[model samples]
Target: MMNILLLYISPGKTTEKISKALSDRFEADGHRVTRLNIGKPGSRTFKEVGSSIFYDMDLIGIGNPVFHLRVMHPLTEFLDQALPYAKPRFGAFLYLTYGGISSGRALLDLSNQLKKNNIPILGGFKVWAPHFYNRVEYPDIEARKTIDEFYSRIKESGYQPLEDEKTKRLFSYQTRKVNIAYHLANVIGNLRELPIQFDQDKCRGCNRCVNECPVGALTMQKIPVRDTSKCVYCYHCAAVCPHGAVICPTEKVADMVRTNKKLIGVENPQNAVYL
Candidate 1:
């Protein structure tokens, strides 16, 4: 049995559901899995990537969500610090979950990034998941089919990188259409950070937001004080607040959800499996 490293960046937990589904399949096939959320504070992505432990891993599967039409990981930065220690045979795959009906360039963007770091991407799996954190519609009927097919193809190939032509066709995730909104958001985000307003009076000092922040952007001082620079604007703080103390733009969130829901299952190739 091989030792598999399944890493993900999930603020809403839907991507985690997708990773869990794959982990289940891998474990049932007698492989040992070490699943980690690299976005979380203590679980640094470079720690594993830079260590000898990563060199020993039989398979590395990285999962991420598409935000603003791009992959949510700062992997190129992390890999810069970690690639010096890495050896050959970088057996790996990609998993992407997008709130929008279309993933745009999310998968291909990441695939190209990893290739630049000299990591051989064996496969990629893409799924259309719910945009909201409260929803649990991941690994749905379509996602399940792709997950099963992806795992089966990998196992049959003996976990090696599949042929170049096949890999290019499936895992590349190519498309001519560009998302102008995504491009605008990317530029806007660089200039300004999203505001997370807190209502101290309503706060009961439960500390849920502080503890649950994926990037540890919040600290408890009187109430939860935020480091705007560190926050990724997941709005998870507002979702987890028990007392409604964490205030965010509810209407914007609703509009994004409504827009995404209306476009569900409309993308020509919403869910994809690469072998």
Candidate 2:
């Protein structure tokens, strides 16, 4: 059995779910799979990071949710810090979960970076999940099928880059335009000192948000107050709040969700674009 390291950053948990599915599949197939969430608190220290990827694993699966047509910042940071310590010539696969504005350039970008760092590409897949901004169905039938197919191919063929023709066709000009708009919206969203607002009345000061914050951006002095400077805008604070007190940039996030839904529609096979 091969030892596989599945490393990913999933603030919204969509990518985390996908990683789990992959891990289960790999393990059930008799392979040893170690999964790590790089975005979690205290998960990115130099020593901790080194220990995860420094060893010689038979395969390394790097994954993240695409934000603004790029890999999530925390995952990028981890890669920047940890890739140097990783063993060279190891096979690696890339996977991305996107809200459906052309997984844009993220897969290519990551694959190129991995290649530059001496990690051979072993194929990649882009799957669609619910948009972080709105309530939507996720990991639907098609998404799971795509996930199963991806692992099946990797198991059968070993390390190989996925065919790019279909992916190129899927990312059309309209998708690119939507992606550009999403990028601009993200920039605007980050300008706010508090991109997420907590409902004072609903907030019970339970400290759940504070503890759940991956970056320690939330504090429970009198209530949950977020330090936007420290926040990477992963939205974990909002996601984990039991009282639903945390409110994100609704207008901007709604626009993004609507744009993606309008352009890409709902459902996996229709929304997902594989590489």
Candidate 3:
């Protein structure tokens, strides 16, 4: 049986859900699977995760919630640290849960990184998730099939490196058309920012946001205070908070999403597996 590792940063749990599904499928096929949620606050450092677990892993799957079409820290740092040890037959796949504005350059960016280390790019999967703070169905029937298809590629005795165009195409049909969005997202990524606010009245002195931040950007002194300098816009704080205390700029983001959705003619959500 092949040893598989799924290391992911899931700020909103959708990516976490997808990773677990993939893990379950890998185990069902009799492959040994090790899954890690490195997105959680207090989770093991990237260097620590890379030094021990990656050595024995035959295949690695990296999952992330695409923010502004990019991968964020913890995942970025973990992969960077793991690169020096990459070896032949150490295959890799990427599974992205995106809010659907655009998967952006995330797949292309990471695929290039792994290719530089000579890791075989087995496949890539993209799933449309509910937009932020709005209810949307995910991992639907089509999405489930995409998951299975990606696994079939892993079972192919030999892995192949993807062509430049095909690798970037994993950004999704919608993401490719919106080239401007990628540039806009790149600008936001540089800021290390999030458009969210906390209400002191509704906070209830809870430290959930502080404790759950992937980068420790939030601190609580009876209530939460965010340091935008450290925030990567993973949106975990609001997702974990029980009270309607964390006020994200949902309308602002949704408006932009709507404009982008219309541009791509997205009527219903879709999922795909890119080989």
On TM-score, the leading prediction is: 1
lDDT tens readout by residue for model 3, 1-275: 88888878777777877888888898997989888888565564765454667777788888878876777765787777777676635578888888756676677788878877778777787887775467666566766787888778756735565666676665445654557766654554444343688887898876877877877788888678888777776667777889989987656656666665565544234577777
- Residue-pair clashes per prediction, in order, are 0, 0, 0
Instruction: Give candidate 3 regions above 4 Å deviation.
Output: 48-50, 157-178, 184-195, 263-269
Clashing pairs in 1: none
| Reference-based lDDT, each prediction | 0.72, 0.69, 0.72
Q: Tens digits of per-residue lDDT for model 2 on 57-165?
A: 7788898787666776667767877776666344778888876445666776787677567766766777876755556666678778888888777667755554445
Q: Candidate 1: where are CA atoms >4 Å away? A: 45-50, 73-76, 88-90, 163-174, 179-181, 184-195, 257-266
By lDDT, highest first, what's the ranking? 3, 1, 2
Model 2 TM: 0.80
User: What clash pairs does model 2 have?
Assistant: none
The reply for model 2, stretches above 4 Å from the true place, is: 88-90, 133-137, 160-194, 232-234, 249-252, 260-275
Better of 1 and 2 by lDDT: 1
Q: Which ten residues in a row have the lowest lDDT in candidate 3?
A: 185-194
TM-score pick, better of 2 and 3? 3
TM-score for candidate 3 = 0.83
